[model samples]
Target chain A: MDEDAKAVATALARESAADGLRRLTDLLLRVADDDPGLAAIAQELDRITEELDQITEELDQITEELDRITEELGASDDGRRPVGVDPVAGRANACAPPLEVWCLPDGTAGASGSLGITYQGPRGLVHGGVSALILDHVLNVALSEQGPAAAGGELSVRYHRPLPLYRNFLATGRLSRGADGELRAVGEITVAGVVAVSAARIVGGRGVRM
Target chain B: MDEDAKAVATALARESAADGLRRLTDLLLRVADDDPGLAAIAQELDRITEELDQITEELDQITEELDRITEELGASDDGRRPVGVDPVAGRANACAPPLEVWCLPDGTAGASGSLGITYQGPRGLVHGGVSALILDHVLNVALSEQGPAAAGGELSVRYHRPLPLYRNFLATGRLSRGADGELRAVGEITVAGVVAVSAARIVGGRGVRM
Candidate 1:
């Protein structure tokens, strides 16, 4: 296969692995009732610990093998994308909650996804930072499609309500063109028809590094 | 052992597992220069993918075992911290980057940590949302130490420069008391003596839910 095809396949495999890990993370956060006697719980815990240890050992071996491969490859840092396959926001990123976006005729964008316990914070609510991350990404997507890529200069977010986990959420971003060639955007995250979080930001003009 | 001790041990084990996964994630993002012959690279990638598949299968089994245990225990959802062991900020959480916090006598809080490729965004820079996450957590910690738990209401962040990944960074939060019983705080994230991000937020009072 060509280099590009190989790269794509590697990314896909990595993303799948990430998805598996994400699912495991969600399971880890789930709380079990105190109904089970301490002894029974302890036994289960012990079993789980043993399994985790085995997994860790396997991972260690993989890391060593990867290190050896790196040396054999005589790898040198290249300017080709500082973050080769970011674990977040990359279409193939496993760490990010799956988000699907649709562009509107007027140049705005809409995104929808469900965040699970892996993204939970503050009781049953989604982490405030996670909300910001999704909103920021969507806003940038809207801007990138319109004109030159820009970096976020300032972002202000208001939490109107808690964004719940394990439920579908919608996010939208709209770009406003400025006369002086500056770009600004506003984004909102809504859950069940309620606007949970709202963000507004100004983007520096072209040549700005994010 | 006792129930409390059992809980602690379980948390520790989960954290260790998370840590292992975190390391694997970092390794996944590190790109080897295109020095290795494509055949060699493909062979290694295939091996890694196979290992990942095995690990994922093990995780699936673990999850099933956990589910069975939960059912046998007659677990019911309780107010007992939905996320029994947070993989993000919990001391026992292995997924989170190591963060150390020191509380000052003057009511401010200081935090230090290094972000890795797992949190990379925007061309090797730390994710903007991650900066907000750590800052928000520190601010809440400062507030909680002073009084009751509060929730983030509004947050404003200005990105003066990109936050670099895989480097030591400093974060600090200071509280501003409001005579009317409101809580407000300001925080900053700095790298190499340069301020990269500054944030300020108003937190809801006693009854606030984040």
Candidate 2:
């Protein structure tokens, strides 16, 4: 397979693994008992841990092999932007929910995703910090699409209502060039057509004032 | 084992699983190459996926067994507050970095943690959102320690400098009860005695207006 195809395959495999881990995490958090079955469940957990250790060893070897290959490939080290993968939006990142983004014609961006129990924070509600993460990513994407590359400077979030877990949410962000030449962006996350979280961000770039 | 012991064991096991997943994710994202070794890495990934599938099936059965036990135990269904486990700061949550929090004598909360590559964003820096997450959790913990249970209303973060990944950072938060009875929180994330991110949050509880 070609390099691009291999990259895609690797991302897909990693995403699948992330999905399995997410499920396992959800189960582990919600699973509880005081019955006699507790002993059996604990035993099963022990077995799972043993299996996970074995997998960890195998993964370590794979990582070493891949590192050797990367060295042979002589990849560039810019150290500013990731070469091909975004740790926040990358499919390989199990911590990030699968969000889809689209750039609108009017210098704004739209995003949509269904968050599950794995993102739960306050009981059945989505973790407030996770919402911030999504908004930060979406706003940055919108800013980049409209202007030069920049780094986030200030971000503020308002929680209008509790975002429920296991529901679809829509996020939209718009970018505007501030009078000071800073990139200003606004993002909103809505659940069931109701605004749950709103964010405003200011970003600094090459020609922008701090 | 008793129920409490079982719970602790389960949490530990889940944490181990999360650690393994985090390592696997970091390796996957950092893995790349254009060399002939790509083929071997891909095959190893395939094997990993198969093993993951088997693990998933086993976890599924375990989930069912645990569910039956929970039913027998007659756990309460508040649905708003998790009965036992906290998905955010729970030791079992792989998604949360290992954060240690302690209440200071001055009524403030101090947290310390070393974030890994799993939280990387913007090249070597910790993801902007992850910073928010850690700050939010820490601030809330401070507020709760000083005041009644409340929900976050507004959170504002200022990024003074990039928080580097895989570095130990100190976070501190203090709560002040406003005249309106709202809980106000201020938090700062510092790296090597330099403040990287500062946050202010207002939380609402009984008698507090939105």
Candidate 3:
């Protein structure tokens, strides 16, 4: 248990799988950032990799069984993972920081979180691609309710400034139909109430739904 | 040593730091992709995180010592890590697959490699943000030689097809000067000799130089 978990005892002791994945990612990123020694770190990582392999094998067996049951029951969602398991924005994925976006009453999707060292580029700044990743996911989430599924067509991003890392960020998106009747997701990520990155995405196959 | 390393004796006995990082990432991704049982996996990861923390602490001490020595000797490149350490394309970064770009005599930059499961977005496709991440780095590598440093201004990426995972990818970039004398980087990523994603960037501060 971590300090917070120790202090709280109950609520934080048994960390949720999503929060655990995020915590694991931060630990890995700590390794990626200062990114110390070469072969030596490799040796340690090699050892851990072995352990992860075992865990993966065990998980694979269970997942296969679960998937088989789901298929047999015909309870699949077109083979698409729910937003809770989304690779980028999903709370469960260890790939990047978890992104939580919600469609507001004003018809816009809004998301906010502080990124850590795992998503860095340009020395203490958020990688531009990361910005794109968040915006794209935010947009998809914004319009998911309006359509059955959303596939990205074209994405354009303009970097207004360098978005710093480990800082609070606010992202918002809204759905719009273009002149050709194509749905579009316009999104942006901001720090300190200032928009630093903006994006417009062309969506297809209906928007992504949770 | 693995079977291959034992067979090769000397050559494969030791893995490079970058290769080791990539290997570690793949193992982690296997867990991320299969994404099997959540809570159990987290427990294992939690244990490994403790080990990694110890390694990080040791490495940090050595890294600080080396940095101090480098500074005392005035052996710094303005704190810029070589392309080898780039967070996205650098072999050392476990964030994404390593991208190696080279300048061709034909006045263009060419790069190629197969991305792994860690970069997946759609079910079996590369994340669009990852495509942007790679293309963005590829272009910067292409134009880096033209100037001292490169900073991205505006980046636009168009996805022609859904790029698959664990497949060979070829990326190319070139240096172009806009009409207003602004330097730009244009690049594309292809799989099976077919262009799947293309990008153009407005670069500043001259261009990123190796």
Query: Which candidate number has the best DockQ?
Result: 1
- Per-prediction backbone clash count: 0, 0, 8
Q: Per-residue lDDT of A20-61 in model 1, one digit per residue for the tens?
A: 666676666664423435365776667778888888889889
lDDT of 2 by residue, A187-208 (tens): 7999888999888777743321
- Summarize candidate 1's per-residue lDDT along B94-184 as a digit string, tens digits: 3455677667877788789898666766666887767777776677667667787556477767778888877899998888755566668
TM-score of chain A of 3: 0.63
True contacts kept of 2: 0.37
lDDT of model 2 at residue A103? 78
Instruction: Please give, for residues A34-92, the per-residue lDDT of candidate 3 as tens digits.
Output: 22342334454455444444434444544454444444434233343433334465443
Candidate 2 residue pairs that clash? none
lDDT (CA) per prediction = 0.68, 0.67, 0.58
* Model 1 residue B103 CA deviation in Å: 4.3
Question: Whole-model lDDT, candidate 3?
Answer: 0.58
Q: Ten consecutive residues with minimal summed lDDT in candidate 3 chain A?
A: A6-15
Model 2 clash number: 0
How good is the docking of model 1, by CAPRI class?
A: acceptable
Cand. 2 TM to true fold: 0.78
